[model samples]
Target chain A: MHGDRLLLGPGPSVPYPEALEALTRPVLGHLDPDYLGVISEIGDRLRAVFRTANALTLPVSGTGSAGMEACLVSLLEPGATIIVGVNGYFGERLCEVACRGGAEVVRVEAPWGSPLDPADLLAAQRANPQAALLAVVAAETSTGVRNDVAPLGPELAGTDTLLLVDAVTALGGTPLEVDEWQIDACYSATQKCLGAPPGLAPVTLSPRAVERMRARRTPIQSFYLDLGLLQDYYLASPPTYHHTASSTLAYSLHAGLGRLLAEGLENVWERHARIGAMLQDALPGLGFELIAPERARLPQLTAATLPEGLDEAVLRKRLLTEYGIEVGGGLGAFAGRAWRIGLMGHAATERSVVTLLGAVRQLLG
Target chain B: MHGDRLLLGPGPSVPYPEALEALTRPVLGHLDPDYLGVISEIGDRLRAVFRTANALTLPVSGTGSAGMEACLVSLLEPGATIIVGVNGYFGERLCEVACRGGAEVVRVEAPWGSPLDPADLLAAQRANPQAALLAVVAAETSTGVRNDVAPLGPELAGTDTLLLVDAVTALGGTPLEVDEWQIDACYSATQKCLGAPPGLAPVTLSPRAVERMRARRTPIQSFYLDLGLLQDYYLASPPTYHHTASSTLAYSLHAGLGRLLAEGLENVWERHARIGAMLQDALPGLGFELIAPERARLPQLTAATLPEGLDEAVLRKRLLTEYGIEVGGGLGAFAGRAWRIGLMGHAATERSVVTLLGAVRQLLG
Candidate 1:
């Protein structure tokens, strides 16, 4: 029953063997001393990876979108104003979540396959001075655009607006210095560059974000995603039970993090950069074109525009069924026009690049 | 790193070998045909287990609490009236979730280790005529009390009050007829009686619950837990991308549910009843008494009161460190007074009962 296809899709890249083995470990009670130790170690390791000493660093029990919701729902109150940068799918999702939270959303846009401009966000901030949060996607999974988060700090400076970054496809693959970048809240999933099975969402909230949530006049709507209670459960001495956390998934995430940290974060980033560059360079030789500009492209996710005559869905299926390779079709604005190929974590290897390139050549050539 | 402890705690009983093996299966994309097949099979299997033909029956991506929040946060809008029956920890949580959702909560109460009186709910329903939801825990894990849900159908027959049951610890271990009992919405976890590791929450929503959610005046506060979007992703013709569902966890849940269905749900329930009776009888012979009344007790969870002067924490610690056995310490109002032993699914066996009994006699004697 095990489907052994080469994972080259936008997420759930091939997990490290040790990490997959961790999933097979005997399940422990969430509060068991052994399991608690795993949770504590994961938190510490996550801080190191995120390059932040924020004590609220831990994995949420759901996937990447859950992390996004946790940040927005906790930091924004109903009637609060949030400035969202819309350049790609995940960025647009931030606007939807903000609107759902009853926040007045001011969206600053760039083209779908391009990075968000800091000047646009600055203008949005000036136009909506009451904006309490500026949300953007650090790495847009849909279009593979990597937004430069460093400039946003100075752009929204001297304002109480907290910066929330969706690091879903960026965290382990790119240089995401949360503390150095001055990001208030950032969330990522394990399936992308972390090389873990999809489940846990690693989220780090700055002291500022925590304080903002603490000062909220209204309680966060969903008790399951409440950051305050989650932090209490993860940080409190003799941690309180906020929910019954999945100790099995936690073990897998911890093992995955351990593998990454062992590889050195810089080395992992360099590997993804190398593999992604190879895929981008080789695909065009097989008649595929890169969608996003090179400078703005994410090393973890590469959105490649299909050749005019090639049917995107048909080719993707052939790659899956014929070559046993999996890659994502485009989403939203880029739908049917592009294909998203992920070079992430364990899947970001020369062999994967060669295998996918050969398969594309076999079918498309 | 695999801690080999006997899981006799309130939940997360030892996963069946097949379920554990399923977790080790190669990961697939969430939208992969193989994975969608798995998801469909799980939905069908869950309906069989839940004893409902409700088309909305499927597992939520988060834990049991996520399922609880999904139902409450979806069915009740801000300022909606929700009367919650609080007889144990989970019931109190229902109240808290309702209040957090901006609902006016009217709590109908009973003692901690007892079931809520059906008459009290009818009165609460009379007092709060506008109440849109009445939530209760079918099996209270904290107190090991199983609330009688059969009478709830007739109590609110003529009203628009939808019943939301937290069957986190009850399903697959007891007789729960979702359609027959006219439950509006019900949720349970993959662990506990399902014999899967804790991750997915199986929730079934009746047509009434779906209609109520569709009629909501306000958008559901939680974008992650919204049942409407989730249904589209799971049940739609071409499933939409809600979030990246964990294929690994889905495989595990499917394998676990298959084991249950293969054994027959009635047989699974009967096995739990027999095992629970054995533990209840044997524990008293060793001078331990069950906290919950026999008639209202859950067969899967036995909250046994400790003998006077015996510190609950110390004894629990000894059982763990000395015998590699894990039983839950008391929670909420029953804290420091009882041990919650779980007999559910693969863990509810003649051997498990004997092993736990032998371990307790060794420690307490």
Candidate 2:
């Protein structure tokens, strides 16, 4: 019954029909040549979607969070300095994971729902010139704010510091250029804009990031996320046995990526933007106030404050139980007072926007 | 095209039809109440399969190796001593991961195709009385060896050390009694004997193991795999958001567990035993020599030496390309000289054995 609910949440947007169909295909062994061909196709399609020529691009075998951990644990060593921009819940997690990896974390703070200032992040990097990585969430899903990764990339050019970006909600729904922006490591999830289920984290690491991982002082603390070993299994010839990669999920992802590329990446982004603007334009008229600043807002995810006197939880429950529309509740600083409406991938359609608006308007009236 | 091939490798055995059908179900948000119901059902079923009543039973988001890392990193802090039994590849990985977590590791060695003697493992534990955990692989997929776990459990009783098991290949295909065997922490993969696609790792921790994790001196290093945080997300009231668990994979695993339970656990186990014995009985006459000793061999996976002067890789490829049957080439020490044939879960049938033996008989002739 829940499967029939229209998913318009912070993640797990409605998956592509092709992806769902692909999942029903019979299982294949991880090392099966045909499965390997599928894996290779996924890699190629990922590179095109990620806009990178990096050979290390492949899906990490967990959710988006695993991708985040994979990039950090693979790059940061004990005593390494990492500058993290904190504007939302995921930004705070970056600092937490980095600190756990024994990295000295320097925080560049921005208010919730506000975009991080790239200048401030650069200043933090200047203060800690030996910083090994400068990380930012390209589109913060928790607050629907888009940090300007483009400004920070050129600033750190030719420096030892790697510019890492978390593009969990941005990869296919918005424009993300990994090589053009000089991002050393970038990770995205399949559930949001990629039009797939929430199981695989498609990640790409630049040659420099791979080099940094290989020159690590200590062995990567987490063997499961070790980039070197993962690369050996995913990219190397005569692929060595690592963990059994999920061929079932890989098939689904391959189908999702194929569908996205077939639709043209720009067209997908344009569709999300057009449909998202339609929702954003309608929210204030329905007594909801938009959270993120206009210029920095992510079109794929819209965060808005609840109408005055509206019991947020009660209204959300009513929408799900009565109207069968699922949206995300606020996270961190915005909890209980905000709702995150997602227009991602296959869910970004005129019908989704109209249906959601009609339900909210009726509830408000 | 590879989807139709018989999966008789070390893992990724043929998935159940119900599980495949479950994958076609529509995607659901991770936090949906109905989805949560499915999660709870999965937990209950996993507890039944693991034969434990531990409240912390749940699936870790990644593969079985992630489960292995989760157990090791959660309980072992820097300077802690762990005694590991290394007989096959997975056992060596246990030492590798524990070492990466900064634990001082003491390894108990055994030959590639032999089981670790319980007396020797006990001696190692006694020598390192301060060991925080003693780990072993219940079913070593690499060499088809089933380490004797029953004896070590009673011997470690009342000791400070917790017993951890890698049940990646042992869970549903063979007999694994977590509570009865006194296993403090155990982990298994879905794709192997569970008749599901490779993605989720069903892991269960005993109350004592949870206590050990809670008392850890250092924070669990891997953020994605931190057991306490994962428990908070999977089992806590009004569940906290940790990672977006893949509902698609969960559905598949849920259906797989459903089929297994419906078949009756004893009946499923008997099927595997009978099918495995049939294959093992016929291998010697077919010019293949069984690798593991009779008492220690796993019923689900049988490792065997290839006929003398026969190229293993060429013959295996012929079986795959010509007969649409997949048998694994040996791993580690057995590489190039042996093959690993799996009779697990849905693939454990007399028909599978007969088809495989007939194919081999023709190929050899």
Winning model by DockQ: 1
Pairs that collide in candidate 1 are none
Model 1 DockQ class:
high
lDDT of 2 by residue, B79-114 (tens): 999999999999999999999999999999999999
Per-prediction RMSD in angstroms?
A: 1.2, 0.9
Q: Give the candidate number with the greatest lDDT.
A: 2
After superposing candidate 1 on the true structure, give the runs of residues whose Cα lies further than 4 Å from its correct spot.
A154-157
Off by over 4 Å in 2: none
lDDT of each: 0.91, 0.93
For model 2 chain A, where is the 10-residue window of minimal lDDT?
Answer: A1-10
Worst lDDT run of 10 residues, candidate 1 chain A, spans A151-160
Interface RMSD of each: 0.9, 1.2
Q: Write the per-residue lDDT of candidate 2 for residues A296-355, one digit (tens) a residue.
A: 988999999998888999999999989989999998888999999999989999999999
DockQ, candidate 1, vs. native dimer: 0.86
DockQ of 2: 0.81
